[model samples]
Target: MKLRKWAMGLLAAGLLTAGLSAGSPREAYAESKQIEVSFSPVHFIFGGEELDPPEGQRAFLYKDSTYVPLRFASYALGKAVDWDPDTYTVTVREPKAEEKVSIDAYIEERKAGDRPILPVDASALQPITIDAYFEKVNYVFGKRTVQPPAELPGIIIDGSLYVPLRFVSESAGNKLEWDGETYAITGVSTAEGAKPYDEIVLEAEQAFQELVSGFTSEFYVLKSEYDGADDAGREEVLLQGARKLLEGQETFRSEILETLKAKLKAGNYYEGAVDQLAAQFEDKKQGVINLVTLFTGKDLTPYLEKAEKELEGK
Candidate 1:
């Protein structure tokens, strides 16, 4: 395949150049450093005009710039690339021959019609070599702009470029399920799993409601006392309400902590978990202030004044 040839050629060129270099062979080798390859000029079109390959890939234009790794391009084209390591070769096969169309043609056709061209959906494909696919796509679509570490384990398999499953799955709004015996992921959501994403958002909203409810109840009790509505009786009510509200806040915090702990124990630290927690905390604090204002029927100037000190102690 043209793509595979280009990859092999680049590899061969690097090896050959390194072998012939005199001093500082690593520094002497040019392509040893990361380089870019562009698909736009070679294959992409926008507004009926050919888009240029990105600058980095253009530098390598002298040496088969059009070549793309068969596996990577095939996957991008929504085809599957099967490899036989024993035979040291790859086989590119489309799911259905009736779907035979180059990526450029596919995109152009979509652009000409009412429908938008969605990314190739490869969720159903079986696992293959992720590394090979990664290298191919990274070299092609990535324009070779970044250099993946050479010694990473596992090949980019299936149609989805295999990344750290934890990061990719969570980002894609999917959960990772681990089977101890086989270590396979079975519960991955396809692109169509908008419901899971919606559920997560809804749960977040409910959590905020719980946090605000307690704060609102406490604020009303505090205001009644400030307004001179039987100080002694109101004090007793305020203290009880404050205690309950504080407990509610603590419970919410505990829920967040428990979720984090579970993720950590499961060996999946989601990237956004910390940020989400912090945002929730801030939202709860603001809710408390808003509730206080509503209860007092006046500006919460005194409480806001002491907020900094209270936060410092916290």
Candidate 2:
């Protein structure tokens, strides 16, 4: 099939949409309270490891309470944060462990268009405004509406919401301690028998990389054979090589999935991590499809479909 036919299928599935919707605009505020606060050089340690806040974002001190960027802190600690402009509410939730992915990676992917990562210089004490009209804005953790103590009310700086450190840590079911002398804040997850998330991801990713390396070596050998073949002989070489490649693809995919599931059963893997493996697998599959198309001048989709049916029948 032509590529446009595939795109039409995507449209029928609602997998494609027109230009993205611009969300509701924030309400204008006439009454506002301006207050001065000092940005402190406070370090953050989460799950026993220190996380460097994105450059230009800092923890600030106000009324003896320390405030950090709302989305940054929540995300680093494996929580989800969302803002609803229509209701002026910020909701943070501890998504189930199995559903949790590395939010840090997700943030990096969307950093270019996100708000919290926007450029700012919060190196010293600066004046910030609290719009009276936004006083009724809600902060929710799970299903509970969080009413921060008057001494530590939420503040906005440079278009980013800032919430008290203690509030964020405890809400995410983590314990927090401040080292006044060192200007460091350490947060430890309070969940019993919680696995080390970063360590698990590192181990799984290393194994996946090794698999890809081996597959790449085999792929190059097949490419060499195909290139050296004459026009008439190329089809036979491609067909024979494609069988081995497809078999290896299925085998590697099954092995990697099994390993990932084992880790998940041990409470150490997030389901979303599987996407990394799937993406790499699909890239290799597409490369094989492209090579077939280049040599035969025909759509490989039907051949791939026939191969699928054969494999299924077997």
In the range 121-147, model 2's lDDT, one tens digit per residue, is: 454436553321113447776665656
Alpha carbon lDDT of each predicted model: 0.38, 0.58
Return the TM-score for candidate 1, rounded to 2 decimals.
0.32
| Number of the top-ranking candidate, with lDDT as the measure | 2
| TM per candidate | 0.32, 0.44
Q: How large is the C-alpha RMSD of every model relative to the true structure? A: 18.6, 20.0
- List candidate 1 stretches off by more than 4 Å: 1-205, 214-228, 260-269, 297-314
Please report the candidate that would top TM-score against the real structure: 2
